[model samples]
Target: MKNNPHHPYHPIIYVRGFAATQSEIEAAVADPYMGFNIGSTKTRLAWTGQVKRFHFESPLVRLMGEHGYRDVFVDGNDLVAGDFADQPIPYQSIIVYRYYDEASNDFGSGETPPIEHFARGLNKLILRLQDKVCANKRNNVSPEDFRVHLVAHSMGGLVCRAFLQNKGLGTEKARAAVDKLFTYATPHNGIDMRIVRNVPGWLSFGDANNFNRERMANYLDLPKGDDVSIVKHFPPERVFNLIGTNSRDYSVLRGASSWAAGDASDGLVRIENATTHGPGADGRDVTSPRAFVHRSHSGHYGIVNSEEGYQNLTRFLFGKLRIDGILDIDNITFPAELDKYHEENRAVRASYQIESAVSVRKYPWQITRREIRENSAIFRTYDQLFPGQPGTKRPPDRSMSPHLFSVFLDPEKSCKASKSVSLLCDLKLLTPDYEVDGVLFLKRHYEGGVIYQRQILVEAIPDTNAAGGWRIKYGDQENNPGKATLVAESRPLGDGDPASGLVFSIPIQQKSRPGLHGALRVEVRPWS
Candidate 1:
């Protein structure tokens, strides 16, 4: 609802993650803005094996600097100090929910409230902020037009969702007032441990029940008996989940929690379970727009404090262009000797590690980066994508293949006032496994195989009102970037199936398998 330049921005209500222990809760309550005010300095290891230091001045600082937002903090007193006489603050305000304040020693009996209570508090927070801002005449925002964006981390994401989706808990008007929601390393599906997997049903110690899938399903009011679904209270595209893939770097809990979370996680939440999910229009229980990052759950390398998270947050909130990348496979080839077995009507297994990295036109940081070495690989698999038997089912890859990643663009800021924004994407297909002579040789089992890599250049129309979604130009760097022929065209996500994303093509070539006749079909959709 907070649309256009006059009310271009929405108040960012930051809800922090879970703090189980007393000391942690106390610390969380003590800070006015909570951890939203924290900053970090870390290393960015370059391709040349050299490291460079980058300082992320915290999301609060970036929002203030880039969007002209200001903190509620003022000269030794609150804004309400002047008898409610202040030139209504900008619509762009940063608010920390302070849900944890009740649990602090300085506050009420030092008890944490249930998530539903937090959700109710969120509803109140929204109305209260609307009343305060609307009181300022310069803002000129109507009562019904006031909107907010939720920026949350860890368990805080659950609180926001509860406020939006849980009917018995959060009011509908408050949910409607929300423009968009973004999460950092949130376990939308209950947190699953390596050994125990999903949180056990009996684990109802304090807020521990908050992580149980069944209880979560009950509280969030997902369709009964259907655990994995995007709650219908909000549009699926409006919520963006930023998943952390680097579990080892999470230093909280003495690294035990990270180890317990195991692989394909941000040390606390697994990649698979960290997004808002529900039945998409295509009837699949798909997650909303989400991307993987090589960051942990919380800490210096945590999702909230990293450059990847910051870039995604800013772009998603303010960007003018959105793209979803999907991999399309036309044909796959096997080595000559291995091809002989396939001709013999034998069982051969293969799965692909669809690796992708995409960067905005001019932003120095990559928006979505995934590689095998980083333990972040999108695995597109087939027990038999191509089968010899009549009963063996080989589904169409493009129709349902998972989207690789998405890139959001603020063309003016990123592309320097260009009508078109360009993205340089690096896509690699790793031979994770292959079957030979009726024997399966996994990626680790084999020494060498054709590893395909290609550079894809995408030109997206910066204006959302533009006629077409995108124009693809393909060529090696050795040739002219402009002369590159357009192989496949792209469309906006809404133009196709709700589950279907933007589509593009990249010809797969390799010295070992030059005859491989397949183009990496990619699809992208505009995300909220």
Candidate 2:
């Protein structure tokens, strides 16, 4: 370890591919069944050396160090084969287990083994790792205990799901053992990579005795009448999948049908296949809540190395960020009285052009900015009526068209004025009727994307409903208080603009209870 006692334990264990025995590994490696079959042993060996170099050496080790984690031990995938005894274990450790054992032809399918088996084996090892740590505590090496956070890639997530779903661990035991589980491109529902000639047809192979697919089904022990479908039994809560894709083509499985069709694949797995879903998902659709990204269809294998893939992965793993909505801009803060660009791109007829431009661009600003024309209105709308003033009530049909505010990100802000800030809008947010419309620009002061609603968290001082302003009641306010005051505030200034851009226009909601003068203050901390 790096000698940092305060470092949060985030030991990452990387499980390599098929671990079928010596002859099997050799046969798979030599055989030309698929595009490139390295078998279990070699792949595990390769991953071992690779992990030591790329992950355990310079870049990855340095990155984790920056994140306040010590350099934990990294074991090869075959540590179960008496490898651990040969390798000297380090301080904090990460034990990677092989999904398929070479000595066992159990992993029937060419893909990774079924999750339940993987989980059973993994959990056994985890229990051992825990015991080892606990032993150290008793030996006077550590003062406190810590939990292990997992970071699995590809099918490893299935293993995590199996581990979590093993109710035998009990809710508390499961939660205590695994604090956070991160998977990169794991296909929770057996990804439909389109690699098979037809999905239903491939699923039919479940009946063919001696067929690889049949073996796989038997190994998993799906309801195949006395066969084993281990994964069918895992729990769902303790896993997080990191979906990745690239615009390149690394997976070239000849003879087999193209899995992605014309769409993108991360080489081996399709973007959709890399997702996770189960009972824990509740009722959300594949695209609801808008979390994962669909990048290039580079094939399944190399998606992790792509720029977009890496960015999304790291963001999901470390940064508590979310793209709530696109920022539509109604007013551009061009210098006062400065001549606005009146190019064909800026005219009212250019709406289609603007929309098209935003769709293809990742960075919102790539959409050219247009000069504002004198007396030119962006668009017109029927003035919608609101619930007229409380006391001076008007007819129910009263309506007014209010200017939409556009938000922006101003990286150059020196804390002088808000106008100098810019905004961050995604191309998807440019869609007119989306609920998150006008949310493109983010408030620079908060360091996170804006949302449409917020929950407030504060302790009320001199708690009085009549008071116009809220007084800060700091520490210990949860009980009795003589605490110092600390003010915490936030608000969901809905999309400020109608046109998409970095700087978004915010819409002001109806005022708080007619007589209440103070603004509604909201506060939130994003889930990272």
Candidate No. with top lDDT: 1
* Residue-level lDDT tens digits of model 2 in 21-92: 444444433332211111111122243456322221222443345454333334423332343544433434
Question: Candidate 1 at residue 76, lDDT?
Answer: 49
The 10-residue segment with the lowest total lDDT in model 2:
352-361
Clashing pairs counted in every model? 12, 72
Query: How would you encode candidate 1's per-residue C-alpha lDDT over 1-528 as one tens digit per residue?
Result: 433344437888888998888888888877777888788898778677899887999889888998888765566444421345564556788888888877778876777778889889888888877788778777777878888889999888888888788788867777887888899988888788878878787876657778888778776887544254355677777789898889888887798888888877888887778877665666666557777788888887778887789889987887766666666555566666556665676665667776788766546777887877777877765543343462354445455454777667765664444466667777777765776545775534544343676677766543444334445555554355523456464444544653334556665554464133456555545443
The CA lDDT of each predicted structure is 0.72, 0.34
